[model samples]
Target: MASTLVSIAGYHVTEEIYNSSRTLVYRGYRETDHKPVVIKLLKNPYPSFSELLSFRNQYTIAKNLNLPLIIQTYSLEPYQNGYALVMEDFGGI
Candidate 1:
């Protein structure tokens, strides 16, 4: 489910959260009885080839981890001229 109500950093997020990355990260929330979750929004206003490659690497790494301790990558979608990853809603480490 895509949202435009809130934004973290520059990427569109579900709620306002402080994240220390160039990409925006948010604690996803919904009014329609939904579970807590973390949503990562890819912030690439003008992505270069290397940046795209790095994102691909991140995708690969997330796919390979496939274990506990690390949040699971549930889905990836194209959004805001970039991509977003919906992951398991494990709270901050």
Candidate 2:
């Protein structure tokens, strides 16, 4: 796995909470409000175009969700050599 990312799109990555073949989830805080957030970073040199598309599709769906069971995505931003999906922090449940 790669070293923990320091920050992405202005959110400070405090700790890596999860990792898998496709993604890395981090505990972060929004720069402006200092609110906790979740950052999902795509692995560098994305394994495949389909994987990248899948991430974007998930973001689009999450962004429009209003259910309490679903975490809403705030935005997508380029990070490092890939992308990061900014989401509401659930404090790792």
* Structural similarity to truth (TM-score) of each candidate: 0.66, 0.84
True-structure lDDT of candidate 1: 0.61
In the range 1-93, model 2's lDDT, one tens digit per residue, is 887565565777888888887778888799999989988877656446777788889889888899989987889987766678899987764
Question: Which segments of candidate 2 are over 4 A away from where they belong?
Answer: 1-3
Which residue pairs clash in candidate 1? none
Candidate 2's displacement at residue 89, Å, is 0.6
Candidate number with greatest lDDT? 2
* Candidate 2 TM-score, C-alpha based: 0.84
Off by over 4 Å in 1: 1-13, 29-33
Q: What count of clashes does model 2 give? A: 0
Q: Evaluate model 2: give its lDDT.
A: 0.80
